[model samples]
Target chain A: MFRAGEVDALIHLGVMHDPRARPAEIYSWNITGTTKLLEYCQAYRVPKVVLLSSANVYGPRPDNPQFLTEDAPLLAAQRFPQMRDLVEIDHLVSTFLWRAQGVETVILRPVHIVGPVHNAPSNYLRIPRPPVLLGFDPMVQLIHYQDTADAIVAALAPGRRGIYNIVGPGEVPLSAVLRELGREPVQIPHPVARPILSLAFRLGISSFPVAELDFIRYVCMVDGRRAGAELGFRPRFGLRETIHAVDEPA
Target chain B: MHTAGVGLLDRLHKLRGQVPDDDIAGRTQALVVRGNEFAMRVARWLYRNYFRASAFGIEHVPATGRVLFVANHAGQLPFDALVICAACFLEPPTPRLVRSMVEYFVPTVPFASYLFARWGQITGTPENCRRLLAAEEAVLVFPEGARGISKSFARRYQLGEFGTGFMRLALEMRAPIVPIAVIGAEEQAPAVNIKPLARLLGAPSFPVVPYPPFVPLVPLPVKYRLYFGEPMTMTGDPDDDDDVLDEKARIVKSRIQSMIHVGLREREHVFW
Candidate 1:
């Protein structure tokens, strides 16, 4: 499909993130697939490219500031091996962005995309009784899937190119979000919950990976000012509506 | 269990009614709004009856600008931070919600993780401090950090080596630093730190008081006298040399140290 000047833009959203999937399969699909896509875009001279990357590349760290800028280092893969493919893909695209000067590559790192999706945050919220780390309720940021779509659309505009952290309306405590959704959270001690969650994942009883426990335990929020200033992007969903989006019929 | 959440709401609403118009200006959430209401109630009681805390020079804290309240931290627990927050909230002409920076380990702790954020506490990151200051909000920072909080009883009232991070933040944000000296917090729990025990537990500092229950979980009800000094406006490059930053930090440290001495002299009794 690489006819010169045939494709104006390429939107790369083909990252596979199945925590239960074999690591080799995920690596090939994510890394090799992104490499091939970027090669095609570069060869085809695709004028614009928008890559959908989650803000989770920064990882949920105990020392992270409440709002991380776009320039913050991607350190999620350090602790969670499952995140390696995603982080590697991000690095690959970022390298392409710098080298392929002809291509306007835009990376949209949206915080926890919820709303009518089968993603982890949405799926976790859908649970009637989600297991919460006992006493750990970090402030969480979520972006509606539709709002994420809006951000991608914004990035497609002419002259929009750098990494952007697309945020939703606002941030709220995880417990408050659960309360708003009316979900009863089972409090499990951190030390024991890890083993139980790991066992559950192995038995195919739960889809959540053990490493993802950090999401509920620490703050991994980002600053969306760059998106607002550059892309003129603002979330259309309110905090209440965004949290309630998981319950919306898919 | 469901009714318990309702009971908590009822109490929170009653507490909300008692506090002045809430002033969490920027980046607020539902929990923070409600949490401030509850914290205000607890802070009032602790300031008045529990600690009998007296706050002076609270007027130095600007009502409508970004300000950093640099205070001397003490007590095995962080009752010192609580008392300083209480002083800023209750004594100021207009109630200000001080977003104090907390320790990294705080987020790992169960209830403290979210509860601290809800009550306007943030992790001690320069970025978090910069953002809060940029939004014209009040932030409380303990330059002494862990060193000051975990000081043993023998070294109580003697200031620890101040960290230079807050000075850089104040300089970068151009926010005035209001030095605070909190007397009586050092006497709240006179304890010695067992380093080996702390290392074995993988905790910061293992403090053991000479009283019943050993661990200084509940601080003694000693009088908390908060001396808020004039706001010091620092002018320099935030990225200056460490020695340069240290010299400037020493100025604020000495200011707080002098205030602590004055507070100690004015006090007649530790409990009163």
Candidate 2:
């Protein structure tokens, strides 16, 4: 599909298809596969490209501040191997598209993308505990799935290039989100939760990789000002509305 | 101490019995004496003032006997090693003074080598390594070697490929490897700019080189924190092959890298 000359822009989705594979394997598929596709784009002289990268690239930042900007360094030491791989793939795609090929590449590091069709298991929702609250002080930045899709469409428009961190209208605590869903969650200290998570990985009951644990302590809070200012993006839903956007009907 | 105050010629003759004429120790001692006066003055000043460097996890450093102090290399500066030497040798109740064997190029410069030799620093040769370890003396080696110092500024904290010689020596001598992380060395010179032309002319980089600001200026007030991780003992079989030795070296290197990262994360600021 990427090689077809008729396609002006190649949007490489299907990256999160397999969550069970080791983080390295999943990353190889995203990063290596994207490299090959980018090579094809260069050979074909494709003028524009948009890659779907995760906001998890920001990793965990403090919840008190509750906003992560694009300028934040990508934290690669987190416990989730997949998240780390996604972060690496984002760098690879951005570097190849912007630096190597000189073709316009727009990267979207969206936070906790959610929507009605988002049946795929996500860290934000599938967390083992009910309330899913971060320890004592936790901050979370999220984006509605519809808004994420719209941002993609906006980037696909003519003559748009650069990186953007997309998030919903506001930030919320994991516990707050869980409360909105009417489920009380157990608040476990990261130190305590980390070992349990590691045991899960060992027992093959959970897919969380060791690297992903780095964020459980630091909550990534990014600024969405650029996405709104430059891309003319205005999230249509707030945290409460977006939480319910994906909540299954009773 | 008063038993032997021999002339230079007499000392040269006396050394023949203990060290062969072709051996490098004679030359090393001569170099040490050449710079002995200046090194003492500097060492005294460093000890009296600005020697406030404190170490965490000092227990990680072996209390006695043979040990390997493996650490990260930050550019061409020897300040980091000097600080380590001062802390270990000059501090109160010094626990088993150490000798750091550095690269051959370090002793190439007349003044630099003299001070280095006077302070018990030696060339990092295989023979010197075996001799030092055999004496059960603590030895310091930057396994990353020259590449670690020569790497571009952008690669800071990302360790370069480590040479396996240190690990081999440790295994051969059955010594414990103590990983040390020295924060703030990178900020001392900062390497803000590199001058390739000056380098070809045998001159140091133009601005912000790794050495002290001026060839004569003392180090500025940048705070340094050295963290030592628990010693990792080589448990590999004595008859392990080269591949095994290389793997052991990598494991040691990774542990050092982790200690460095942890130290950096714990620090509030490197420049303070």
Candidate 3:
């Protein structure tokens, strides 16, 4: 499709489906591939380009009590699989288009995009039961699928050039998400967890990649106030709504 | 007049059969092979650990052979040379073949000498230099020589006066000189102060003192970084006068100094 010019814009999704994947591998696909595609688009003179990146690019940095802004430095260096890759891809796209190609690039970095369509087995729903009840205590910012789609559509409008962090209605602790799913939570010590994860990694059964373990230990949260103010991106569903919807039948 | 003529005639007769003996040729061959093996092992290890070593403007090294690696010398340790060798070996196309000009003192040690000799590392002698270049081998030379290694810690990376011999050799051999600027070596041995006894013993250009106190003992894992600048092609005619050679040498030295400065500026903190 890219070679034939059948595509006007390319939405690079499908990076995190494999949780056991390496950070470099994810970076190559999502970030490097996106940059190459953008270069191709620029070469072919495609005017509008849209990239679906992760708000994890902000990294698991300490939140300022105040809401995070898009102007904040995308966490360029992190131990997370997708975070560093996303930041690099974001930079590569933004710099290439703005500096070299002059193509209008709109980047949407959404945090923990969630909704009913998230059927992937490894989605937060499938995490081992123990952590659910204990409430992992990790602060999370998420967006509903409808809001995600809306943010993607909004980028299509005129003058959406740089990056915007698309976050959900509000932040919630990790334990809350797991508790909502009705699973027991266990606090595995890091030393024990690391070796077990490494062994599982060696055996090739554990869904968690080593890089993901880094993020589990270190939290990442982004402020989407810029996305709200500029793109009018308002999450249609909050944590309560997600819980209710998940509980309800199709 | 009769005595002088007799002496001259005797010298001429002795010069007739001046070919290198079989033992010497065999020794040279053995040295080259050993050197090759040592270089290969070091290169492979560095490749696994810190290979590619972050290079910028490698286009400066000419694609062709007979290029000279002129770099700064820091401390008595040969880390800079080892790094350069490793970096060149790991370069894209792999400059696996480099003949570093080592000090004659290096070969005095049994194991190190054997390795250096095997790698075709020649003493920075004019004869050996010409022979190596004539054989089309890449020669690495530190023009600052002993002066560079003996400098105070505060003056590290600030190149001392480059010895003119490397320039003269390059001009004579008609080789392109590649200026290399290396960082992370000075910190490898933060010379607190040189002991007077070591200097008196002539311990590797002594008194100035060079040894990383924490390493090898406590094994402080100091991060090492190296940079290679663009090759500054010798512009003047090879047959140029001594003045021309001096001028070319100064230019090469200045280029190397600038590259080192750039590397130092770009780095956040030197030690660590």
Best by TM-score: 1
> Looking at model 2 chain B, which ten-residue stretch has the lowest summed lDDT?
B1-10
| Model 3 lDDT tens row, A27-137 | 567756776777787777676788887766666532221234566666535545435555677787768656754566888888766655543212545555532211123
lDDT of 3 by residue, B1-272 (tens): 01223332233223222333253234333434444555666655653354324566655655456788898987556667777765665553434356677775553333453345445455565656776777677789988776676566687778888877887788778787888887767655555445575567555554333453422222123445666676666755666677877887889888878888888788776544
What's the lDDT for candidate 3?
Answer: 0.61
For every candidate in turn, the CA RMSD to the true structure comes to 5.1, 24.4, 25.6
Candidate 1: list runs displaced more than 4 Å: A3-5, B1-31
| Stronger candidate by TM-score (1 vs 2) | 1
Ranking by lDDT: 1, 2, 3
Please give the DockQ score of every candidate, comma-separated: 0.54, 0.01, 0.00
On the 0 to 100 scale, the lDDT of residue B43 in model 2 is 50
Q: In model 2, which regions exceed 4 Å deviation?
A: A1-4, A16-19, A22-24, A61-66, A77-80, A100-102, A117-135, A210-216, B1-272
Let me know the DockQ for model 1. Answer: 0.54
Question: What is the alpha-carbon interface RMSD for each candidate?
Answer: 3.9, 28.1, 32.5
In CAPRI terms, where does candidate 3 land?
A: incorrect
The per-candidate TM-score of the B chain, in the order shown, comes to 0.89, 0.75, 0.75
lDDT of 2: 0.64
How should the candidates be ordered by TM-score, best one leading? 1, 2, 3
